[model samples]
Target: MLDFRMDTFLAVCQYMNYTRAAEALNITQPAVSQHIRWLEEQYEAPLFTYANKRLSLTREGELLRSMALTVKHDEQMLRRRLHDPGPGAHRLVFGVTPTVGMSLIPEPLARYHRLYPDAPISIRVSNTESLCAALDQGELDFAIVEGYFCKSDYDSLLYRREPYLAVCGAEYQFEREPKVLSDLLGETLVVREPGSGNREIIRRALSRENRAVEDFRSVIQVSDMNVLKKLLLLGCGVGFLYQAAAQPQLGQGLLRAIPLEDFQESHDITFLWRKGSVFAQRYRQLFELLSPQDIEGESCAAGD
Candidate 1:
């Protein structure tokens, strides 16, 4: 079970405003203050500072926040594992970033269902950061993510390495024989929202070229995969994504890939779960079933 006071403190950290936190928790602002005061008394240190109408976590607050999150996660996991699966019922909760959710999970999920037809599976699809936050809250048994995360905190396995390509509508014209990062300066860019794995990969690659998102002529940040693809097909802007994501469009000649001259961005897709989780065995089985090589091979065979 999770502690109410800890939950209140976490809400405060998340929103960074006492009133907002109170509203979120459906508690009075003074009650929220009372909980913080109680925690401060126990910990013997101030957890937050109020200055210039801004709220910031004190050093002690930061440490408590981390510990409280860990305790909450551990408690959730213990409760889950202690509960019986029940006769002929196997339940699971998992998450994935958009890219992996779109490309990789379907086949394995299908196979898993075939093995345990009566089992119920819950799937959550979001960006890397949100998925990671859900994992910390113990809402997911495991996750597949496409962006950078704190590898030290989880037991992670490399799922695959995928190339990120610059693509645009097939009918769109380039200024010249565009090949490098600099050649993209004048193109409107369709990008993923902040905290996206794809966005992080693009940001790192741009940094290497001494460029940034602002260097583009224009930027359109989209969170929905379908909308982003529609924008690309409509010739709204150039986009960056995993090769797998844009492959079908490229094959249909609806889009064209522009290889970066002397510059290609690649990111690792990884399977992640909490450190020392009891679900490690179950996750390993899933990893073996959904390994990129096996999935890719099956895809190729199906295409044939």
Candidate 2:
């Protein structure tokens, strides 16, 4: 078990103010200072510093914060494990990007339910950054994400490799048939908001060409996948998405592919959890149960 003072440390990390941390922990401001001082003494380093009058973590502090967060999450899981009423007492908590949640979740969830029909499950759909933060905070057991994440901070299993696609409405036509994205630079670009995995993927791809989403005549950011697809199908604008996500619509000729000569790109959809999670083996088992088939796109088993 970790020292209870880690709670105070995390609170300070959250609020960045001793007074607020103390108030949240129902302790005095001086007590919060003492807790921090004690931790600094034990760790033999200052954990925080002020720059431009704003409190921020020191290198040592960042390292401690990462380790402490894992401890906190592990403690929470330990409590849940100890007090669990039996099978299905605790819902299986996990997250997925909107693309995966929309296209890949149902079949695997059905498979899980068939195997353990009484098990409760909770699914959170959000962008990659938010999902990773939730995993660090112990709010989620795992995530299926398609964006960039710090490989050093998490353990991952390669879920699938999905090709990126640029699409417009079936009736929409580019002025030059868009052999490259340069031909479509004048059209509006419909994209997911910041922190979304697919959006980041395209952003990096564009940067390689000395361009950006801003290079488009206009840009519309939508968090809802359905609305984004509707806008595309209505010829409102062009959008980039994973092939799996657009498979049904493309097959139906609702969304037409714009084969940008520059965009021969694909991204890995990964199953992510904390680097040193106590429940890693258990999560790996669940990954196996869901990984073999059931997803609509191509997939293969990945090593730990």
Off by over 4 Å in 1: 41-46, 49-55, 58-60, 74-88, 150-155, 274-285, 294-304
lDDT of 2 at 209: 79
**How many residue pairs clash (N, CA or C atoms closer than 3 angstroms) in each of the candidate models, in the order given?**
0, 0
Off by over 4 Å in 2: 1-4, 15-29, 52-54, 87-91, 292-304
Error of 2 at 98 (Å): 0.6
- Over the stretch 81-140, how does candidate 1's per-residue lDDT look in tens digits? 567477555566788888888887777778778878877788998998998899888788
Q: Ten residues in a row with the worst lDDT in model 1?
A: 295-304
Residue-level lDDT for 25 in candidate 2: 92
lDDT of 2: 0.85
Clashes of 2: 0
Give each model's whole-structure lDDT. 0.81, 0.85
lDDT at 91, model 2 = 49
Q: Weakest 10 consecutive residues, lDDT, candidate 2?
A: 295-304
